[model samples]
Target: MTHSERTSAQSTVDIAALPSVPKVLLHDHLDGGLRPATVLELAGECGYTALPAGTADGLATWFREAADSGSLERYLETFEHTVAVMQTPAGLERVARECAVDLADDGVVYAEVRFAPEQHLDRGLTLDEVVEHVLAGLRSGESQAQASGRRIRVGLLLTAMRHAARSREIAELAVRFRDRGVVGFDIAGAEAGNPPSRHLDAFEYMRDANAHFTIHAGEAFGLPSIHEAIAFCGTDRLGHGVRITDDIDLGPGGEARLGRLANYVRDKRIPLELCPSSNVQTGAVDALENHPFDLLARLRFRVTVNTDNRLMSDTSMSREMARLVETFGYGWPDLERFTINAMKSAFLPFDQRLAIIDDVIKPGYAVVMG
Candidate 1:
C-alpha cells in the first residue's frame, strides 16, 4: 500500500471506509488522470517511445516527482505522453472508459471530467468525433460500474486550451453535445500568460446560449486572473481557486477579513474547486498542511475538494478527503459537506443535482456517518 493509504489507516477516522462514500468531482482533468499502466500501453500502441520509465509504478513515481518540481508549466509536461496516445478514437475511448471505471471504483457517483478536444486532432479526428468517442466510453464504463453495483454518472466539460485560439469553437461544440452528455465548457492551461479574458468570445458565446462554463483561475496566477474569470468572463465556477487565499486577511487570533473579491465570491456562492494535493504539486501551496481549504470552508467560500489530476498528484476523491481529514481533523460530516457542496455546484440541471443529493449523497452519507 502507498504511504497515503497507510496514513489514512492510522488516522483517527477509518480511512478504509472512505471509498464507500459517494463523491462528486468537478475539476478533474481527463488527460491528467490516466493510469500509469494505461499510459505505457497507449504510448506503446502509438509507437511513441519517449516514456521515462519502463514499468508502471516507476512511471507513477516519475510523474509525482516531475510534478513536484516547483513549476506548474513543467508539471503539465507529463500530459504530452497521455495526449500523444489519445489522438486516435480507440485510444480515446479506452482511456475515457477507464477514467469512468476508476472514478466509480473510488465511489464518485457524479463527475464532470474536463478535456481539451483541440488536443486530440492530430489523428484526423474532428473535435466532434473526439467528444463522441469519449462519451461512448463513459457510457460503457458507467454501465460496467452499475453492473458491479456502483452507480456512476459521468459528465463532460469540453475544455479549450487557454493559450490556443479554439475557445469559441470548443464552446460551440460543448453546446452541440450538451444534451448528449457534455455538461459544460471550460478553458484550462497555464494561468500566467494566458488569462481567462483571452477567451472572452467563448465565454460570451456560452453566456448567450445560457450554458455553464468554469474558468481555470486563481491557481498559478493570483486574484487578477480570478477577477477576469468572474468579473469579466463570467465563470460559473473557479477551477482551483486556491490562489484566492491571497485576498484574505487573517488576524493573529484567526479572524478573517474578506476582501471585496472574496466577499463577492462568497456572497455569490460561487464554488471553488480546491485541489489540495494538485495545488501543492503545482506549487499553489507549499504543502497540504498549509492549504487554505479549511479556512475557506470555515469562512463559507463554497469550497469543494477535488483531485485535479489523479495520476500526476497520485490522488483520488477518497484520498483527497483522507488527506483533508488528516490535515484539518475533519470527520464524516465535514466530508459529507464537501460532497454536497460539490453536488450543489455541479453544472447539471437543478432537478438532477437535487435528486443525486437527496437520493444518493445525503442517504449515502447518512449511512456512513451512522
Candidate 2:
C-alpha cells in the first residue's frame, strides 16, 4: 500500500496489533524498566529490606500508585527502592538483560536505554565495572532474541544525575566505552533547581571528544531549561520536551504562531522525546488528551514517542503508541513517521542509522501496513 492509501484505509488501529509493528525508542531509563518480579528477587539477593511490597503484583501496584503522585520530585523518590537493589553487579546485569528481552518482545527494533552509574556505587563496584556488566547482559539478550527469530539493536546511554557532581566523570566514562556499547551521554534527575547549565563542563567535555548527548529538559521545568540545553549545552535531542508548547501561540481562528525559541527548535529539526503516560504521571501535562503531541506533530516538529519510565508509568513502546493513537487518532502512517523520526534522531552513526531505516524499519512497517 502507498502511504496515503494506508493512512486512509487504516484510520483506526487495533490497539492489540500495536505490539507487532516496529518501534524505535530514544528515551527509556534503564532503572525504570525493571520487572516487578526481578525487583523482588534482586532485593532479596542483595539483602535489601526497603521494598514496600512482598510480592511482584503488590510491588507493581505500589510503584504505579507512588509515581502517580503528580510531582516529579515525589515520582523520583520511587527510584530509591529500585536503585537500592541494583547496587550489585549481578543485579544490574539481570535488569539490563531482561530490559533488552522485554523491549525486543515488544517489537522495539532499536532502543537506547540509559542509567546513571553513580547510583550503583554503594556495592563497591567502579563505574567501569558497572557499565561492563550491563553491556554483557545486553549482548546476551541480543543473542537470545536473535535465536528466537527477533532482531533488536540495543545501545547504552550513560546518564549522570543532574543533582550530583560526577557529570564530567560520567561523560568521560561514556566516551571511554563509545566503541564498546555506549552510544551517548545524558544528565537526568529532577530538572527543578538543577539546571542543565550546571553541567556545562560535562557537555563541553563531550563536545571536545566529539560525542553525542541529550539533556532531560522541559519536563519538570519549562522553556528556560530547554533553551539552556539547546543554546548552551548543545544537546542533540531534548528528553521529554513537552513544554516547548509554551512558546507557541494558538489563535482562536486555529492559526498557530511559533516564538523565536520554538521556531529555532522546529527549524533546527531538534527531536522531542515526548512520553505521554509518564508525562501525565509526573504532571507534565494535565492529562493525556491535553498533551501537545498531536499539536507538535501537526506543526511538523521532530517529535518522537518514548516510555520515560516503563515500570512507573506501566508503559511499553506499544502502550505509548497506542495511547497516542487513542488520544490523537494516529494511524499506521503516523506511527511509522514517529518511529522513523526516532531512528533518524538516534545517536548512532549516519550510515548505521540509514541502514536500519531502510532495512528494518521500512520493511517492518510495510508488513504491518499490508
Candidate 3:
C-alpha cells in the first residue's frame, strides 16, 4: 500500500477502545486542575466568599466560560479563583494529590506540573514553605496512585510569576529540590510585556547550576516573545509555542517551508508544548482546524500535546488527542510520536527518561495499537 493509504487506514482505528496508552504530560498546572468540589471546600475552609457558581459541575462550567472569553486578561481571571483557594498547605496538598490521581486515570504515566509558589503565599507562607507543601502533596499523591496500581511519577516545576522578580529565588528553590521532587523551573503569567529575558539573571543562574527550565511563550503572545525566550533566555522547552506557525509557509499541495526560527526549532528538536484548547481560548489561533499542530507534527518538530490548565480549559490528554484526530485525521503513529516527544522533553534524568520510553511508553502504545 502507498504511504497515504497507510496513513488513512491508521487514522480509522478506535482510540478510546485501545487498551491502556501511556502518556507523558510536561506542562500541566497544579492550581488550574483542582477538582471543582475541592475548590468549593477550600474556599469554605479558607473563609473566602467568592465563587462563580454553587455546584461542582457548575463551578467547572463557570471556569471554562470565563477562560473562553477570548481576552487574555479575562482568561487570567479564572486563575485568580483557583489560586485564591490554594493558599493553605491543606488546600494545596489536596489539590496536588487529586491532580496526580486524575492525570493517571487519564493514562498519563509521567507528569511535570507547575505553579507559582509566590501566589500560594497569600496567608503569609514563605517561598520554601510553599514549595515544601506542593512537594509533600505530590509525594502523597504518588504513593496513593502506586497503591491503586497506576505507575505514575510526578515532578514539580516551581513557576515564578514573570511580572514579579522572584524568579531568582524560585530558581534557587528548584535547584535545591532537584534531588527531591522538583525537576525543573518555569516562568509564567503575562507573557506579552513580561519577556523571559527579563529574568535573565534567574535563567543564567539555572544554567550555571545545571538546571532545566521551560518558558511560557507564544501563547497569548507571539513570535517575538518566543524568539527572546529561546535566543535570550535559553529555554529547554517552550510552553505553547504555537505562534511559531507564523514562521512557516505551507506551499501548494501541502508542501511546507520553514522560516529561520521554525527551522531552528525543527532541526534542533526544540520541544513545543502546544495546548490546543488553551490556544483557541486565548485567541492564539482562530480555530482548531487552523492550528499548526498537524503541520508541526508532519514536519517532525518535537511537538508535545499538553493541557495547560485542565479545569480552566476543561481538557484532558484524551480530549486533545481526539480533537486532533477529528481535525487533522491523525493516526496511531502521530499519537505515539507526540507521547514520545513529551517523554524525551521531560525533566527526568536521561536514564529515567529512556526507561519510560523503552519500557512503559513503547510497550503501552504497542498494546493499544496492536
* Candidate with the greatest lDDT versus the true structure: 2
Model 2 misplaced regions, further than 4 Å: 1-7
Any residue pairs clashing in model 1, and if so which? none
Encode model 1's per-residue lDDT on 86-200: one tens digit a residue. Answer: 9988899999999999999999999999999999999799989999999999999999899999999999999999999999999999999999999999998899899898889
- Candidate-wise lDDT, in order: 0.92, 0.94, 0.88
> Lowest summed-lDDT stretch of 10 residues in model 1?
4-13
Candidate 3 positional error at 187, Å: 0.7
lDDT: the better of candidates 1 and 3: 1
| Per-model TM values vs. the true structure | 0.96, 0.98, 0.96
lDDT of 2 by residue, 103-151 (tens): 9999999999999999999989999999999999899888888889888
Query: Highest TM-score, which number?
Result: 2
All candidates in order of TM-score, best leading: 2, 1, 3
lDDT of 3 by residue, 1-370 (tens): 8887765665564767432678889999998898889999899999988898888999989999998987777888898889999999898888988998888888889999999998988899988888888888888888888899887999999999999989999999899988988999999988878888899999999999999999999888888999999999999999999989889888888888889998998888899999998889988888999898888888888999999889998888888888888898877877888999899999988999999999999888676554
- What is the number of backbone collisions in each predicted candidate, taken in the order shown? 0, 0, 0
Displacement of the residue 161 alpha carbon in candidate 2, Å:
0.9
- Give the lDDT of residue 298 in candidate 3: 80
